[model samples]
Target: MASLPQALPEPRAAGPAERPAPPPVARVRRRRRPSGEPPPLPRQLRASGRWWLGLSALVLLACVAVVATGTIRYVDVADTRVLQAIAEIRSPALTAVAEVLGLLASDPVLHAIWLVDLVLLAVFRRWRHLMVWLGVGLLVINVGAAMATTLQRPRPFEVEVLGEWSGFAMPSLPVTVLAALLVSTLYSLVPPGRKRTVGKWVVCGLLVLTAASRLYLAQDHPTGVLAGVVLGVATPLAAFRLLTPNSVHPVRYTRARPAHLDVSGDRGAAIVRALRDQLGLVVTDVSPFGLAGSGGSTPLKITVKADDTVRADESCVFGKLYAATHVRSDRWYKLGRTLLYGRLEDEKPFQSVRRLVQYEDYILRLFSDGGLRVPQPLGIVEITPEREYLLVTEFIAGAREAGEAEIDDAVIDQGLGIVRRMWEIGMAHRDIKPANLLVRDGTLYLIDSAFAEVRPSPWRQAVDLANMMLVLALRTDAERVYRRARLHFSDEEIAEAFAATRGLTMPSQLRRMLRQQGRDLQDQFLALLPFRLPPVRIQRWTWRRAGLTVVALAAAAIAAYVSAGVLAAPL
Candidate 1:
C-alpha cells in the first residue's frame, strides 16, 4: 500500500564548463526472487526419466547382442590386454589391497549397506522414496540375474582369478547393486542442490574404485562392469527424479507441518506471476497465514499492489493453495470416512486439483450471492495448470475467530442467523467450527466453504445447527445460547439437531476445543430441551466399503512380507 519516493535530478550550475547533466539514476527496489528456475512439473520429470530408461535399455541390449554374436573380435582382444596389464604390476601389497576392495564390493557388504538405507528411509517416513528404492533394487537384482544366466558368460580367461566368483560373469550383480544403492541413498537422504551436486562426485569416485577393483582381481570382464554401472545408475536415478521429486517431497530435517508447503522460493515467485497474469492482480507479497488452524491447504496472505487497473483500496486478499498433494489428502480423507461410515452424505473424493479449487470458488460465490455474510469471491489463479491453483477471496481485516471475539447477544443471533439462512437455501456448512467462523464490528462471517454442500441431507443440516450451537456455547454458557436459538427454531427441530449430531459429526478442531472445556457441552445443550430423540445411525454397511476393507488388508499383508524380507534376509 506504500511506495518509495523517486529520486529527482540535482540542480546544475550555469557555466560554460558544465555540459548537459546526465539523467538522474532511477532508484530501483529489487524484489527477492527465487535463485533458480521454476521446478519442472511432475509430468516433465516423468518424461525425462522415461527417456533415460529407454536409452539405458537400448545400450544394454546392444552390448548383449555384440558380446553374444562374437562379431567384434577387437573387443575381446582389448579386454584381455587390460587384464594382462594389471597382472604385470601385481604385487603382494597390491594384491592385499585389491582383495580388500573386492570384499567391499561383495554381496554381504552391499546388502548390509542396502539394509541400512532401508532403515533410514523408514525412520524418516519417506514412504514414497522407500517404495521406489525397494522397487529399483528388486528390478536390478532379479532382471540382472536372469540376463546373466541366459548369457552364461564365464570369468576372464588366461588370468588368475583372485577374488570370489558367482553364477555367470557378464553384467556383474555386485556392481549393479552398489550403483543402485548409492544413487537411491543420495536422492532419498540428501537434499538436492549444492549438497547433491557434491554427492554426485563422491558417489562416482566410489563406483570407480569398486569397478576398478573388480577388473584388477580378474573377477569379471571389463565390459561386464560397464554394463552393470549403466543399468545400476540409470534405473534408480530415473525413479527418484520421477517419483519423489525434490520440488514436491523435499528431504529436510525440520519440525514444520507437511501439509504446509514452503512458499519462500520458486513457489513464491510462481504465485506472484500467476496473480498478475491470470487474475490481473499484482501481488507485492505472499506469506503463510493462520497455518496452525489449517491442515487441508496452505493459507497465504497476498498483498496486491494498488494501480490504475486495480482499485486503490484493494491492498490484500486471502488465498489458499490447492496442489496435487492436497488432492490426494482429500481422497484419503473421504475414503477413510466412507469406510468408517458408508455413504455418509456423499463422501466422494475430488478427481483433481482443478475440481477442488473450482468447488470452493463456486460455493463462495453461491453463498455471497444468496446474501450470506461470507468472504467475497475473487476468482481462482492457475499456478501450474491442473497441478496447482490459488483460490482468492477478500481478506476480512481486523477480524478474529468467533472463539476469540467477545460473545454477546448480537453475536449469538448472528451465529444462529447463519445456520437459519443455510437451512432456507437447502445448503449446509458441514464444517461449522470456531476457526471457520469470524467476527468483526458486531458482524459474523463464515469461511472455508470447501465442505459446504447444496441440497444437503436433512441429517447434515441438523448436524450443522448442532455444531454451530456447540461452537457458540464454548464462548458462552449453553443455556443462554440455547434460549436464544429457540427464538428461530422449534423445540422439535432442536431435538432433531442433537439427535443427528455426535462426536463424529463435529470437526476435529471443534471436538478438541470442547474436550478442553472440561465439561459435556453437548449433553448440557440437550438437557435444556423438553424431550430427547433416539440417536441417528450414521454407519451403514455397503458392498463398496466391504471391498475396500478387503483390498486394504491385502495391501498391508504384502507390504509386511516385503518389509520382513528386506530387514531379515540372509546376507
Candidate 2:
C-alpha cells in the first residue's frame, strides 16, 4: 500500500526535533575521518612535487648565478666597448627588424592585447587561469623593475634608442616582459597536441627573434638580456608553486572524503560537538549516501543513538552539509546559474552555507504548514563560524526519483498540489525536476529547496510549473503532462509560463533522459508557442552606466597614449 496522504498525520515543526534511534545498517565501509583537512594526495603527485621543488630551486639558484655574472661584466666591460662590438653585427635590415621586435613586445599595443585577453578570461570566470598569468606576469615585471634601479647598469649605444627610457640597463625588461608573456601564454593555453605544439614553437621562435634583435641593435649588453630571460622564465615556475591548487588534476564534484568526519581534526571535532550540543542527537556512525556524489551540498546518511551511545536504536537520519567555500569550479557554476535566467530569477543564490540551510529550512517548514510532505527539518549544526553548516532531516526510506518511478495519476496530482501550494504562497521552487522529486511508499516528497524563494514574480512561478511539467513528461508523455497542467492553467498562461523556457536550464540528467526517449524538452516547448518570442535582454542601458563606460574607454585611450610615448623614450 502507498504511504497515503491520510496514512501519516502532518507533524508541525516547533524547533529542532531529536530523531529516535533505530537499528544500524551493516557498514560496507568504515572510513576514518581525515584530520579536518583534505585527504592526503597519493604518492604520484607528492613524488612529482619533490622533483618539481628541486627544479624550481635550481632555477632560482640560476637566477642568482646570472646576477653574479652580469655584475662582473658590468664592472669589467665599458658601455662604449659593448656598443662597438654589437655595432659590428648591425645592418639596416637587422636594425629595422630588431626595432620592430622591441616595439612589438614593449609598445602599448601589447599591453592592450594582454588586457583584452585578461578581460576575456575574467568574463568566463577562469579564475585559476587568470591568477596564473597575472602572478607570473607581475613577478617578472616587478623584479625586472627592481633590478633596473638596484644594478644601475649603463645602456650601450644610448643614441640608438628610438624611445625615451629612464630605467637602468641590466635586465632589459622588454625582453623580460615579452619572454614571460610568451611562456605564460603557452602555460595557460593548452589546445590539441598538434595545434598546441605549433603554437608553442611559433611563440618560442618569436622570443628567440626578440633576443637576437635586442643584442644586434645594442639595446642592452648580452648579459643584461640574459639576466632578463632567466628572471622572466623563473618567475612563472616559482609562481606555479605558490598559486596552483594542491590537487594537480582536480575532478569535478568530488565528494569530501570520509576523512572530513574524522573528529580527530579540530574542525571535524567541532562539527561533531556542534551536532551533539545543538541538535540533541548524538551521532555514532557517519557515511556518504550511496546516491550522493559530488554536488554543491554534501548529503550523508548519519546513524545516531538517542542516548548518545551505540546501545539505542541506530536511527538513520539524512544530513546535508553545505560548505562554507566552494571549489573554483563550483564558484564558477554559481556565476553561470545567475547568467542563465537573470530576469526570470526570483532571488540571489545562497550567499553562505548557513544562508542555504536557513532558506531551505524556512521553505521546508512553510510547505509542511501547507500539509505538503517534505523531509522534516530536524536541527542545524554549525561547524565553523558562518562557513560550514549542516541540516539534519528525517530520511524518507525506500524513496525513488520520480523520474525513476512510474508517474501515475496519483503522482501527477501530488505534483500539481506542490505547484498550487507555491502559487498560494507566492513562492517558487526554481529547480523542480525529476531528481528533486521523490516518491516513497506511494507518497510524493520534494527535495533540494535550496533554490526556493518567496514572493516570486509570476514568471518564476510559471517556470516552476513548466519544470514540473517537464519532470512528469519524463515518466509519461510531454503532451500528457501539458494536458494535466491545463486543468490548472489556461492555454495562454501555460504558453507564457513556458515562454520562460526562452533560456531554460533543463538539468543535464533530464536532457539525457529526454534524448533516450527521443523527445527534446526545448523543441517540445517551442512547438507549443504560436510565435517566436524575442530574446530576453539581460543588460539594461542607463545614463550612469553609459557614462562609466565612456570614462573607462577614455582612460584606456589616455593610458595607451602615455605608454606609447614612454615606449618611444630613449634612456
- Residue lDDT tens for model 2, 16-102: 234433344332223333565442222123444455446546644654665677654543365557666767777788777778876
Residue-wise lDDT of candidate 1 within 240-315, one digit each (tens)?
8767667566787787666677787777887877677556676778999988778888999888765455554346
Candidate 1, clashing residue pairs? Answer: none
Question: How far does residue 342 in candidate 1 sit from its true spot (Å)?
Answer: 2.8
Predictions in order: lDDT = 0.79, 0.61
Work out the TM-score per prediction: 0.84, 0.54
Regions of model 2 farther than 4 Å from truth: 1-133, 150-295, 305-314, 324-342, 345-354, 384-387, 479-495, 502-505, 520-571
Best by lDDT: 1
Compute the lDDT of residue 333 as modeled in candidate 1: 80
